[model samples]
Target: MLDFSFGAVAMGHLVACVFFLKFWSRTRDELFAVFAAAFALFALEQVLIAWAGLPKEEQTWFYLLRLLAFLLIIAAVLRKNRRWS
Candidate 1:
């Protein structure tokens, strides 16, 4: 059951990546590029999570990819909102 859930999540991430990449291509926006990269990383992380087969207690390392993806999103938002003098 867990495998099925992981597969579904990975597929969702892949779809999101594709959409983001398409938007980036159309808009030439750094924010969309960052989003696409983040979603791609999320898809990779999901695969790694399934591949590792580690117990919940030992899954900390796998979470780092998620952290990096979130950080990329945060950085992109901040960059977009920064005021230009």
Candidate 2:
């Protein structure tokens, strides 16, 4: 059940990444490009988790990868917001 869920989540992330890429292609928006990259990292993390069989005990580096993805999102938002300036 857990393995199935991980696979589903990974696939979902990949789909999102593709969609973001399409959006970036149409609009040429750097935000969408960054989002696609972040989602790709998310997919990679999910695949690693599933393949490594460490659902509960992910290593520090994996968590860092997740952190980087989230940070990418936050950075994008901040960069886009005028109030942050």
Q: What C-alpha lDDT do the candidate models reach, one value each?
A: 0.93, 0.88
Task: List the candidates' TM-scores in order.
Answer: 0.93, 0.85
Which residue runs of candidate 1 sit more than 4 Å off their true CA positions? 83-85
Q: Number of clashing residue pairs in every model? A: 0, 0
lDDT of 1 by residue, 16-76 (tens): 9999999999999999999999999999999888888899888889889999999999999
* Model 2 lowest lDDT segment of ten: 54-63
Give the residue spans of candidate 2 off by over 4 A. Answer: 58-60, 82-85
lDDT comparing candidate 2 with the true structure: 0.88
Q: Pick out the ten consecutive residues of candidate 1 with the lowest summed lDDT.
A: 76-85
Candidate 2, residues 7-78, lDDT tens digits: the string is: 999899999999999999999988899999999999999888878876475555677778999999999888
Which pairs in model 1 have colliding backbones?
A: none
